[model samples]
Every structure is written in C-alpha cells, then in structure tokens.
Target: MTQIATIIGGGVIGGGWAARFLLAGWDVRVFDPDPEAQRKIGEVLDNARAALPGLYDMPMPAEGALSFHDRLEDAVQGASWIQESVPERLDLKHRVYRDIQAVCDPAAVIGSSTSGFKPSQLQEGATRAEQIVVCHPFNPVYLLPLIEVVGTPANAQMVDGVADTLRGIGMFPLLVRKEIDAHIADRFLEAVWREALWLVKDDIATTEEIDEAIRMGFGLRWAQMGLFETFRIAGGEAGMRHFIDQFGPCLSWPWTRLMDVPEMTDALAQKIADQSDAQSGQHSIRELERHRDANLVGMLRTLKARDWGAGAVLKGHDKTLQAAGRIADTLSDIADPARPVLTVDRAVPLDWTDYNGHMNEARYLQAFGDATDRLMQIVGCTPEYIANGGSYFTAETHIRHLDEVRAGARIRIETQVLSGAGKTMHLFHTMYEGDRALATGEHMLIHVSLETRRASVPAPQVAEPLARLAKAHDSLPRPEGAGAAIGKR
Candidate 1:
C-alpha cells in the first residue's frame, strides 16, 4: 500500500519534506494558503529529482503522486504522516494541530517541523496531545539525513514510530531524550550564529570570510567525524582527556562574545546584507540552490563511499530500499535463470563523470564490480558468509568501453555466470543505457578463505546456487566481446 504524507505549509522546509516523501515513494498532499505554493514546491522538486537519486548506487522507488489541496482537512484525510511546517508561532501551531487531529486518523503521526518549540509545548491544548511530536529536520530535507525527534514520555511510542517512518524515507532520526529549547543540533547552530553575528558586527570577519574559515578548515573534519570525536583525535596518542586538559581552560579566556547579542540595527543589517550581496549576489536563488545541491551530492557521495557518518545512513537506506523491492526494472528479480541476471540499475552520479564531461573510465569497472558483488550475494556469498571465513577475490578483469555516457544517465548491468565451479567464478557483465550497450566487463574471481587468504573450495550453501546458475546460463549465446583483447576489434 502507498503511504501518504500531508504537508501543511509549502515553504522551503515544507517543500523539502514533500520532496523527500515523494521521492521515497510516499504520496504527498500539500496544503498551503500561499498562491505560489505550487510553483515554489515544483521548483524544489526539480532540484530534488536531479540530486537525490545520484546519492545511491541502486535505483530509488518510483516517485509517488503529488497533489495540492486548498483545505487542511482534505490534505490530512488519509495521510499516515502529517508534517506541519508553518511559521514558529505557538498559538498558530496549536490551531493547526487542533484542526489536523480533528480530521486526521488518531493513530497517524503528526510531526511538527518547529526548530525551537518543545514537543510538550506543541502538545499543549491539543485534541490528542500524544500524537504531536517535534520532528525537526535540517534544510534540504531531501539530502540531509538528520532529524531531531523530540517527544515527552507520554508520546514515547509515537516518537519511536516516527523514527521508523523517518528511516523508511532515508533519514536519520536522533531522538531527543528530554524536550529542550532548540533541541540538540540547533543549540550548537544558535551558538555559532550568535558568535558569527558578533564577528560581523565587530569587524572581525566578513560573512564570506567566516564561511571560508569553515569550508576550508574544521568543516571537512566535522563532516566525517563530529565534534567530540574530532576533538579526541586532536588529543593525539592520549585522546580526549589530554586534549581537554590542554584546551579546556581556553573556554574561559573571553575569546568569544557568545553570551552577548548584537543588536540587529538597520545599519548593521544593511552592512551584513551588502557584504553577502557582494560575496554571492551574482547568482540567482535557483542557481545558488543548484550549486548547493550539486556540491552536497558530491560530498555525500564521498561519505557514502566510506560508509561513515551520514554516509552510513545512506548505505543502510540503500539496503532497506533494495530489500523493499524498490529498484529499477525489477533488477533484483531473476525471472529467468537461463540468461544474464540484471544486477545493477542506477544513475551515474555527478562525481562519476570526468573533466571530459563523460562517465569516467574507472567508474565502469566500479559499476561492473558492483554487478559482480550483486551476483555473489544472489548466489549466497553474502556479508555474513564472508565475515565468517570465505569470499570471492577478483583475479583478472577486462573492460571494453563501447560508448560515452554522461552523468545522471540511467545505466543497467546484466551479469552472466560464465563458469562457476570449485574455487573459480567467471562473470561477464554488460552495461546498458536503455537499449544501447555502453560497456562490457569480464572478470575472473577466485573463491578464497578469508583466514588463509588463498583459493578455497566453496561452501555447500554457496556451491549449490553457483552450480545452478552456471548450468542455467550455459545454454545462452556467448556475449559478443567476452574474450576480446585490449587492441582487438
């Protein structure tokens, strides 16, 4: 059954929620009184469509239906998740919740995207207070995975359910133990914002200079290893204790005006605005958004490669998506064992392309390598099996690049088990863009014992399936370029 998510406000955050849900295969019903809500959300969706799918090596689920509704009741009619992203006004939020709970399914989760409001505060004077939880997500909800889920003990169960729902949509839900002002991440952000404002007001650094300081230095470390862990590394061989002993006293040195608030007088505001305009005003908002999305996609892809931090979340989401059978052209389904099995079906990520504006040659091997890994998993050489003692090690590879393909192009790889017996497994993978054959890779692999790091006979569980697939594919015609040499036609 298709899940439904109703978005109550179609501004930046609301549109991001809509895009995230829609891209994750949830039907989205948006209710915003703003006349240009549709156009605004449409633009956000356009950016989302171009960026999110590239983050994964597997295809995403088919996009769900998107509709606009004038009335809040109509939008919440059948939604399992209702996200309220209105302005941060407590009374206005209470009113929205009252209307939502009156018509929404009592069991349905009603999440508020309020950055500062506590769940307890939002729950006050509500029809069903337990149904409301604060699910504060970062900007560009489609890409960034962090979501601070805050709830009282009375609504603990609902908060758990919200976390599960968030995971289903490829988001990281950091459940806040106790309701507090601004939650966890925002408190840190507020501190930074406060200091940044003071810096600009005191002529210490311009906005651009401040941004440069972040992107050029600690921001990279923070992206992979967060604050505490990064600081622990800073301790060198001794760890966190040593580092804290050295730097902790500096906290009281009055280096920052964190407790002081710079009055946002018109003159100050204009000075900051003028500086910002000079720094990045040449590009339109849409262009800036596209640049942001592209840069995020590239950085996130790097994280995904290492399976660390936010990248681990993305990797787990890919597994969940694959397990749910939300893949392109039923790539996981082997309808006929007598032919090549469709293994990899995904879009070329922006980072996969080269300076020549085409998919890099090395990425071809990577895609084919993924296809080989898929085939191994299908034949029972899974992670658990490998972790126990055995796995395949590719001995040799030959790749033929038949055509040039660009980024964002959808590619599929079908693998044929050429020889699977004893300690050897040979595979031929053909990569395609629609019906056009773009590349072919032939790989010879040796089954090995992880302990000894040498060739070994396959376990019965793996051997049986391998034999079956090899026999099943034996009758198929040989692939055209299977055994061709490097310079041969």
Candidate 2:
C-alpha cells in the first residue's frame, strides 16, 4: 500500500532504496543535491530494475514511474514515505528535514537511512517531529532484509506504525529500544571493523584472511540469522541465558576495543588498500556489486527455505509481491511424460549472476516463474488484459526441486490450470527437458483490480478467453490437487 515513495539522496544507499520501492511497485521520486545524482542513480536503477523483478517466482507488475527532482521539496510532496539517504552529516540532514517538514503531507513518514545518528538529533527543529526516525539499512539496500528503526520517545508511536508499514512492503524493521550513536547493528560492525584495522595495521592478517575467517566461519550463519539467534541455537537446550553465562567471560577479554576508533594513518591505509587489491584482483566495481547481489539472493533464498529471521522477511515479501502479478512471454514448449526433467531445463537468465557457478536461488524461482509466465500467456492472459485493470495475482505456490540446476540449460515448462473461479485460479507447472519434469510448481492466483488492490471481475477481453478455457476443462476433473485459496483473510 506504500504507493508513492520519495528518496532524498542519490548515492548507493538511496539508489538501492529506490530499487527496492520501485520493484515493490511504488512510484518513486528521487531528490539529491549532487548535480550528477540522476545519472548515477539511473545507472544503479538500470541494473536494479533488470535484476529485481526477475528474482521472484511470479512476474512483478511493470515498475512504477521513476522520476528525479532537482529540489527536495518537490520530491517529498504527496509522497507516502520519504527515505533520506543523504550524506552522514548533521547540518545537511537538519536542513533537509526542515525542508521536508514544510513539504511532506502530515500523513507521510520520513525515515533517514542513518547508520548511527539518533532520531532526537536528526529531527531537531523539525515542525513535524513525529514523522521523522532513523531507518538504518546495510549496504546493498535492495538485497539485505534488515533495517534498524530507531525512534525517539516523542516519535515512538509513529515510528512503530511506520515499521509495520515497512513490513507490509517486505522489509524487516528492527525497532531500537533507545537512541544511541551508531544505532545497534553498526555498533557490532564498528567493533569488528576496529579489530580488522588493528590486524591490518600490525601486519598480522591480510584483508582476505580476515574476510575468510569471518565468511568461512560465523559469517555464513550470521547472514541468515543474527548473532543472538545463532547463539541461542548453539546453546542447544540451554537457551540464551545459559549461552550468555558460558561465553560472558569473552566480554571482558581485550580482544576488541569496541569503543575505539582507529586513527587514519597513511601506512595502515596503504596496507589495507594493497591487501584489498591483492584480494580482489582486477574485478570491476560493477562485477563486485553483482557478486554481492548474487550471493545475497542465494543466501537469502536458502534462509527463506528455513523461514527463520531474514528468510522469514524474504518469504513475507514474496507473499506481498504475489499480489502484484508477473508477465511472461509465451513459448512453444510442452512437457514430455516419459523422461526425467533436469532442474536446469527451465531457467531464466537473471542479470545479477556472478562468475560463481549455478544460478542464484532467487533466479531459480525467477526461472520457474518464467515458465509460469509462458504458461499464463498460452492460456490467454496477456499484458493488454492486465493493463485494462484486470490481472492475476499469485496467492500461494509450492515448488519442489529434485536436483541442482546450473546456468545455460535449455529449459521448457508445462502448466495445467488446477482450478478456477470468479476471483481465484490455480495452476500446476512443471519445468522440463524435452521429455522430463524437472521441478513442479503449483500456484493459486487471484483476479484483481489494479486501482482497488482488491478482487474484481476480470475484464471481458481477458475473462472471455479464460472462461472458454475453463469451459473446455469443465468436464475434466480438477487436477488431483488442491485449488488456490480465495477470499480475504
């Protein structure tokens, strides 16, 4: 329901936020002080728009309008939500907030993508103080699920409501109990960064070594579940209290100076840069970003399978998107019943895949989705129908993968409408090779109005064809499966 969003910054973080909101189907307006903000953001948005929609199992609706504003007030006007990702400086943020207060509607929520600055500090002198809060997201804003929401006492109620709204849009909002410098996640990150600096400064470990130690070890688990949840599981039946009791001694160790900020010396800076250069070699910045996004898509999808923490957020977002519908081009492929279809038989090329082997998991869903799209088109649901204010939104889906699929496999998909109704439709999809079923996806879809965001009669142009198909299959028994659930919760 977050239909219009304004992004007040065109840096990496702001661009990522724009991608996230735009992909989620919000009309996005971007404002930034930099003269080249639009160009930089456009480049980022180009990759984002190409990669984001393809991550899901359903075709996402066409991205909403993406426009840039030379003035912050112009961007904030009438926006439902405003995200400020401006430079991390107090005076600039204050100026922006003052301008936002004068322009943003009373109902709109204003969030600052600040890593550490508190709401109290960020909202100083703002007339509409309750509307402002800090929403700290990690780098690669579009991929990471966690956004720390820090609110001052005066704005806590408004911020909590905003957090819920963010959840509705597929973001995980962690509400900080109290305001603190650097907020919560950054505090932990700052600690690690401090140690990383010490290691580089003393020539004890290379940048790659430190990265490996974390990634090959705890970093993997931390990516899916946070530090505390992992520790809770690690304690087995003992729970958090017991785990804390056992490891509390580490708290006193001189291993990390959590409060210390390392001095920026040229010798240490050069060493860090040289080590990083040696670690990454000649990969371009774009390549590195693609790698990061690919890994994020894979790891997040894996965690989504477990439906714990970050994965839970991804799943929830997927559900929200299910309502948006996707469009796929029809292909002239059918399933052959006699062979074992490999998973790679039906795949779509996602723009974000890196040099790493295998398609990222999000793209796997996207591939199966491409097959689903072709199936829908074959059955007569076209973009023209959707544009006429009628479209199919996926309600639920269950996909089973029997094997691993690598990239570049010639894939085909077969679909069967499991059931249909005025408001709901069910489909069975099989990704296939020439004669085999690789993966099966059963989905339920709802017919909806684009403007209402509610169930509505399908347009005659689209409905007539679907009704014909329904009649053709009426005498045929429903597929030996459950139909999609219909009606509102």
Candidate 3:
C-alpha cells in the first residue's frame, strides 16, 4: 500500500516537510489556502529533488505521487499521516485539528509543526486531542534530519510508530520524554538569538560578525560533535568534568546578555537585514541551497567514512532507501547478450580532477567500483540481501588507463558480467567520456556470508538472478584488455 501523507500548509518549513515525505516515496496531499503555495512548494521540491537524492550513493525509491487539494478535508481523508503546519495560532491550530479529527483516519498520526505551542496547548478545546502531537522540524526540512517530537503521556503508545515513520523518511526523531516549551534545540537557538539581538542593539557586533563567529569558528565543530561534545574534547586530558570545572566559573560572568531582551526598533531590524543582504546578496536562494548541499555532501561523506554522526545516519538510511527500490532490476529489464549494463552516467565535477587538471587515476577505480555496485544490485546482491548477511566481496581488480578525462566531462560506465556462478564472479567495466573509452577495470569477486566473514554460496534467490544476467551477457564480444597484464603493453 502506498503511504499517504497530508501536508496542511506550504510555507518554507511546511513545504520542506512535504518534500521530505514525498521524496521518501510517500504519496503526498498538500492543502494550503494561499494561491502561491504551489509555486512556493514547487521551488522547495526542486531544491529537494537535486539535494536529497545526492546524499546517498545508492538509488532512493521512485518519487511518490503528489497532488494538491483546495479543501482541508479532501487532503486529510484517507491519509496515513497528517502534518499540520499552518501559522502557529492556538485557536487556529485547534480548529484545524477539529477538522482533521472529522476526516482523518483514527490511527493516522497528526503532527503539528508549531515551534512555540506545546501539545497540551494545541489539544485545548480540540476533539480527539490525544491524536495531535508536536513534531517541530527545522528549516530545509528536506536536508536537516532532526525533528523534535513531543506529546502528552496519553499519546505515548503512538510515539513508537511515529518515530519509525520519521526514521523511514530519513529524519532523526528526538522523542521528548517530557513535553516542554520550545523543546530542546530551539531552546538553545533562542539563547543564541537573544544574545545576537543584544549584540546588535548595543552595537557590540554586526549581524555579519555574529554569523562569521559561527561559520568561521565553532559552527564547524558544532556541525559534527555539537556543544557538549565539542566542549568535552576541549577538556583535553581531563574530559568533560574537568573542562566544565575550568569553564564553570564563567557562567556567572556578564559575558553574555542572554537574560536581557533588546528592543528591536525598525532601524535595528533594517540594519540586520541590510547587513545580511550585503553579506549574501550575490547569490539566490537556489544557489545557496546548492552551495549548502555541496558542503553538506562533502561533510556527510567524511563522516560516512568515519561511521560517525549525521553522515552515519545518512549512510544507514541509504541502505533503507536502496532496499525500498527496484532501480537495479528495472534497469536490468533490458539486459541482453550483446550489450553491457550501462550502470553510471554523471558529470565529472571539478573536485574529481587531480592537481594536474585531469581526472585522477583513483577516480577510475571509484567509477568502476560504482559500476560494480550497480552490477551487484542487479544480480540480487542488494542492500536488503547484504543487510541479511549475504554479499559479494571484491577479491581482486586490474585496470588500464587508456585516456585522460578533464574536469566537467560527462562520463558513463558499461559493465559486462563475464562469469557468475555459485561462489565466484567476474566483471569488466569500461569507462567512457562521451564515445571515447577512457579506461577498463577487470574484477574478481566472491559471494560471502558477512556475519561469518567466510566464503559462502549465495542462497538460491540470489544465485538465480546472477545466473540469468551472466547467461544474458555470455554472447558479448570480449574486449582486448580482458586478459592483458600490467607489463609494457
């Protein structure tokens, strides 16, 4: 059954939530009164389609269907989940919840995207109030993983499934054990914002300087380890306790103006806005989103290599995404004896080039590895299969560089399954820049039981697909590079 999510607003945060669910293969129904809601959400979806999919190496589920409805009732009817992201007015939210209760599925989880309102406040004067929970998400909900979920004790049982649903969409649900005002992350942000307002009001620092203080310094640290962990590391040989002991005395200092609220006169607001515009006026929001996505991708990949933090979550979720799709099988539908599987097609970004301005030698191996992964996906060595402890381990590889590829080149890989049987497999991948062959990689791999870390024949289900693909490729003309050694020739 298709998972249906009803999104009740289409503002920046609401549209972002829509993108997240829609991209995660949930059929989404969006209901917003604004005439411009579609255009706004469409822009958000464009950014999402470009950024979210690139977070994973493997393919995500085919994007789910999206439809817009004018009536709130039309949107919520039959939805498995209803996310209410309307403006944060208590009475308005309660009215929306009452409307949702009338049309929503009894088991459907209704989440309110109110940053200031607690679940108890939202439930006031509302029918079926037990069904409403606070699920506050940050900006660019399509990219950021955190969603602070809070509910009353009466709704405790519903949280487990809600958490699972959030996880399925690549979101990290911090289940608030106790419902509190502003939740956790927002409370920290409020303190920072308060200090920033005071700084600007007192002319102590400009908006640009405040932003610079973050991005140029501790923002990088906070991105990965966060406040407590970063300070713990600062403790050095002593750890968090000692670090706190050293810094604890400063907590009482007037160093921070967090306790005071600065009156935001129009002039101050304009000063901040003008400074922001001066700082980033050159780039549009789309350009910024791309910039943010690129940096995020690099950071996430770094964390992925370390198997730590958000990147680890992203990597783990990639497996779930891979398990959700039939991309490899869909591509393999056209498998034939004379044709190689056209596995990867993408532009060679500037970052892939070496200092000499040519595609690095290692990139050829990387490209071949991607092709091999695609081949594995097609031959039933899928993420799900691997998760269940069945997979192929690369035992050997040989590659020949035929030509150089420059930056911004469009590249493609064609993979030929040379031989595949019970325990062993052979694959040949050829890289091309347009029509010119750039390199060839010949590889030998073995099926293994990941749990035992030993060679094992795959189960019949896996072996069958491998056999079929191998038989289909049996008639392909072998390349001249197939048996060539690394000597002079």
What is the TM-score of each predicted model, taking all chains together?
Answer: 0.90, 0.70, 0.79
Please provide, for model 2 over 290-366, each residue's C-alpha lDDT reduced to its tens digit, 9 standing for 90 to 100.
76766766676667778876777767776665544333232223243122112222223344354565555565466
Clashes of 3: 0
Q: Clashing residue pairs in candidate 1, if any? A: none
Off by over 4 Å in 2: 236-246, 259-261, 323-489
RMSD of 1: 3.3
Local distance difference test values of all predictions, in order: 0.90, 0.72, 0.83
Task: Answer with 1 or 2, whichever has the higher TM-score.
Answer: 1
Candidate topping TM-score: 1
Instruction: Give the number of the best model, judged by lDDT.
Output: 1
Ranking by lDDT: 1, 3, 2
Per-residue lDDT tens digits of candidate 3, residues 1-489?
899999998998889999999988899999999999999999889777766765665656667999999888889889989999998788888788888898789888999888988898888876776788899998879878889999997688888889999999998899988888898889999999999988877888888899999999999899888899999999998999999899999998889878878888898899888888998989998788767765776676677767778877888897786565433454345535357887776556444667897889887888899889888877677798899999998888899989988754667788888888879888988989778999999888999998899999998877887788788888888877886642224
- Candidate 3: worst-modelled 10 consecutive residues by lDDT: 326-335
Error of 2 at 38 (Å): 2.3
